[model samples]
Target: SKMFYGGVKPEMVSDKFSFTEGPSTDKEGNVYFTDQPNDKIYYWDWKTNKVIEFLNKTGRANGTHFDKDDFLITCSDDQGEIWKISKDKKVEVLFKGFEGKRLNGPNDVWNDSFGGMYFTDPLYERDYWVDFKQETP
Candidate 1:
């Protein structure tokens, strides 16, 4: 279903990557999206119409969000880790294995006002990956 607007034409952004997910935005209206299968973060500068890769080897980063301090919080699928990336490119591992058990691969996540994180775990079978046969958290 397509909605029509008066006197407005739809424009498309240039394609740079595939498997786009984890769409988020900063205070300046710049859009951020992830290429999950490629393990990369991409940024679209709204002002200049430029797209760029923010990070590589991003732990197969999937879902992402901006924290209150504007840091990028991402669920890294490859290492099953949660990462907090500061503006100056400092990477912090917020969480790895829960109770000494590897997660089912954190699929999505969010942070509370007090910086508490709530994430989801779902079993995802990959070509080179094994089952996460651990107790659920």
Candidate 2:
């Protein structure tokens, strides 16, 4: 059996982000995370010990989860949509709006074993939004 370093302590990865949220990992142990205020997703390569931008202009992604197919499902708060990102970095909108009204804002997402998706929508004010206002639901 392989023994690991039991005394290892958590270390700071980076301090340059405005605000960080939604951290997930792939099967290869590569970590993916979002910086919503910056509208970017970062990739932390386990083998390289380096962090780089995986995606930019990401629609202010907040939360993310990896599906069974290894695709990345993310909450895009900028437009109240859910996005699916492929391995090739192609982005497709999964959920746009609920009924006729736009969603409040997608905060997080999860994939079930039955191939179902669950996400959270919460109303929050954004400085970039000028065309829409929050409505009572």
The candidate scoring highest on TM-score is 2
Q: After superposition, how far is residue 86 of candidate 1 from its true place, in Å?
A: 1.2
Please identify model 1 stretches exceeding 4 Å from their true place: 1-10, 128-137
**Candidate 2, RMSD to the unseen true structure:** 3.1
lDDT of 1 by residue, 20-134 (tens): 8888887787888789878888888989988878888788888888887788888887767888887667889888888887776777877777877788877675554555454
Model 2, range 72-121, lDDT digits (tens) per residue? 99999888889999978999999778887788889999998678999988
Error of 1 at 99 (Å): 1.4
Which candidate leads the pack in lDDT?
Answer: 2
Compared to the true structure, candidate 2 yields what TM-score? 0.91
* C-alpha TM-score for every candidate: 0.84, 0.91
